[model samples]
Target: MAISEPASDQRRAFVLDLPQRLVCLLDGASASHGRASLLLVVVALVAFLPGFFQISPIDRDEARFAQATKQMVESGNFVEIRFHTQARNKKPVGIHWLQAASVTAGEAVIGPSALTSIWLYRLPSLLAAVGAVLLTYWTALVFLSRRGALLAGLLMASCVLLGVEARLAKTDAVLLLTIIACFGALARAYVRPRAERTGDFRLAFIFWTAMAAGILVKGPMTPLFVGLAIVALAVVERSGSVLRPLRPLVGLVWCLLLVLPWFVAIWFATKGAFYQHAVGVDMLGKVTEGQEGHWGPPGTYFLAVWGTFWPSVVLAAMAAPFAWRARRDEKVRFLLCWLVPTWLLFEIAATKLPHYVLPLYPALAILGVMAIERGALARAGSRLAGLVWLWPVLAILVSLGLGGAYLWFGSGFGLAAWPLLALAIALLWMAARAFPRVGPEGAVLTAIAGALVLYTAVYQAMLPQMRALWISERLAAVVKEQGCPAANVSSFPYQEPSLVFLVGTDINYVLPNEAAALMKKGGCSLAFMDERFTGNFEKHAAAHGLKYHAVATISGFVYNGGRLTAITVYRSDDAPAGSGAAR
Candidate 1:
């Protein structure tokens, strides 16, 4: 009853052709303009809404950005940005203004509470993330099939980097929106009918306005990225005429009109200090030397793409060979023009962060979608089966990795992880069955859905437990629970900015050796020190003529490395005779 060689070969060929047929059908359905818009709307909601405010603001970026915006709300100084009296010069004022406006709107509805209202500060990022996804989809539709546009939108929605940035208070998500807007508009203008597109003025205005917003959000980096793309496109097309519709002379006027008012005002307010720090130190320093300890060799961003894009990265890698094969094609050349130089520039830059190349991710997503639409995966024959199976295999590994990471950090998997684990197992089965039955696109979509589930689990289950590790919320609660006066508390070694925001007090920063000096001026003072200083707390207290006892010990991870630290609270018995405290 075994099949003959010819029959088996025929069946195999039919199976291989299924993906192409399904993709064509999908492309036809996606061709409807309304469907694409609806798909983008769904991506926007899913990308921004769920778990947007599930956890508190994190340390470093989110906490710092939120605090700065909070200061703006309190001070009403829109031109000069400040984070509790320390000038915040790391970023342009655009993000702060947006955050402030969001907060203001939220206040009108829910009443103002800087200490509690995080969702308002995160709203702009959510909206911007949605805009980035929509614009990327629209851009893909310019040159790609309908199926490619849907895939591109879905891939971006499922990206771990965009997901994280969407829910946080940061500049990257907003910056991404502007990048997509400007570039997408340029693509539209370039590809449209020459008579209709040329001197459209409206498109030129959109491009310039988006670029202006980008300059305001992150400063010169915006113009640098867009300008570089323009030059690359001109070279690849071998014609300067392609750049004509951009109307640089008039566009520059529009850009300056949109961006200069605040720059001039801030210059007068900071006496040019803001520009010196934001432009000179934070911006150019990354080019001249490593900044913020982010120095890496050329391969940093190449490696980062794997983690940054996650499930989508597999397709991105799969797209490379096809892209190279079709390098002569104009659309392929345009995508390469967008992705290559931007990627290379980041790699060559002296300083690097994982999210620095976020603006280029839309291109990667587009290329990956194009590869799938062109039937690259199905054309691989038997190799396609293995790649399909890789999805479930990686999903299981990610589940185990998440659980193991928490346990390694001395945290437990919460109840929410149960559903997450079940979802992973389901994805494993779906991937195993789908490729053989449905097609590669089916398997890829399943994988992308699995990634969304993973992000949900991370935000709802893992982050709440991990919040205390990077943030001071729990530590601050402990101080309040112990009835310690805000004025009497001090942190030794260093003070995390989040601690100040969380504890609602000014914590004096002191060194360990200086602990004795604190004892002399105290009324039953309490000191928080790094765990390394715990053993010597009693010894130091006794040496300084004070009685000390450990109150509580709190620990968590605070930085990029998985290193954990314990913070110990110590109480002294001595009370200043004349210094009666107010409760």
Candidate 2:
């Protein structure tokens, strides 16, 4: 049944239409409609690379999570999270579970030291960020064109705030991804009306389940955000009918089933100490008291996000108008509901941090993509006219500014200096060559990603040298080498949990008043002192009749004001005396 070629006259007509067919194929390739999923994977990889390379271990909240997880793995205690030998019931166990899994897996492959590396601590967050990026792209595509979807992916990938979060071991990324997945599922359910009722039900159930998981990760705020967004979307769309398919009874059961086990276990184990700390202090008190020394003005967060999430900020701004214009549109309304409420809620809170607003980023990215697409079509003529002339002028100015910064502040013209200078020059050249054809949006985006990647790469390359200047790790190593039991060592004035985690020990703070009393009962005691606390130590130790000799002065790689002071470890004179040596 082979088909014969057409007659000569018919063949001539077919050949005449071949140009249109070829143009259609080219358009399809350019839009990359079939490969959108692949693009999302690529963007996620890009978002993850910086986090992978940057391994400057921070002794903050992330260190606490890692420590808790490590203890969980070793002790086989998965129900309650502990930090520095105390039941840390303030947060939920979702992040701990992820960290524990990463530690366990990494140990199997790379052995136990993986627990100490920044990568193991940060891997969960990085993976969650990747998931968030994929969800963001798919969510955007639900309502937007293919190009808009790509733009949204770009926005998420280039967001500095998200990038920073990806590199830290924190629950925020987990919370963010869970919320996003929920919303994405909901959006999908809404978009396809003829799609099976079962599909919608499944998606809704999954959304609620993810919310429950998020609750386990960061507590009630997860549901609070998800609930608010859903309510707002329902109100805007006048879609009272949309809620029916969610199957509230089944969904509620699912959520409770997923979340209650941990609560019950922790409640029984800690005899309600977990409940009080988690519900009373962690949730209510944290919001009202603004604990952990976190304080900010009402509008501070709005400004902070703007600075940290630059370039993405430009897209967010563009997206705002489109979101408003499409307020009646269900998809846009959903994104607006998610973005506006979450943003306002965080902004009004007494305790505000930059990462608190991460939930809104995906929504904002969607809006940005919409705005860019609309702008591109609306100003196509003007874009073509001005883009060619504007790029070279901007490139030259950027080049000069970069060169000036290096000449003024960087290590005055050495091998290190030249590489940075060369990078700057390359970026400038790229801007000049790419801007005319690609237009402002593409040019700006490419430049931002390039610049950030370059900066992150340089920072990561220098981190080992930078970390050597911090004595916390080295001091902790010394304590471990001496076979200091995990429970005995206490920090004075402040706590460096990272050190405790590194040394596989517990560290308690010696309150200003209790310092002397603790020193009197101490065994082979180690006390850390900096310039700020040297006076306090002298004043307290003299009052208590406790004598101390410096057992070690761990010099940090970085020095402040020609004084090589970071952390100094002291041994009590009561113990068998050892020589004070700098590590």
TM-score of each: 0.86, 0.78
Q: Give the TM-score comparing model 2 with the true structure, all chains together.
A: 0.78
Number of the top lDDT candidate: 1
lDDT per residue for candidate 2 within 412-449, as digits (tens), equals 34245336535534553454344444544544455454
Model 1: residue 304 alpha-carbon error in angstroms: 2.1
**Colliding residue pairs in candidate 1:** none
lDDT accuracy of residue 261 in candidate 1: 93
Candidate 1: deviation at residue 441, Å? 2.1
List runs of model 1 lying over 4 Å from the truth.
1-35, 47-50, 193-197, 382-385, 408-413, 467-471, 482-488, 512-526, 534-551, 560-562, 570-583
Top TM-score model: 1
Give the alpha carbon lDDT tens digit for every residue of 81-198 in model 1: 7764488877888898898998888888778454446777888999889878878888898878766787788788878789889888889999999888888877876675445545
What is the Cα-based TM-score of model 1?
0.86
Name model 2 segments beyond 4 Å from true.
1-35, 51-54, 193-199, 376-437, 480-490, 507-527, 531-551, 555-566, 571-583
List lDDT for all candidates, in order.
0.74, 0.66
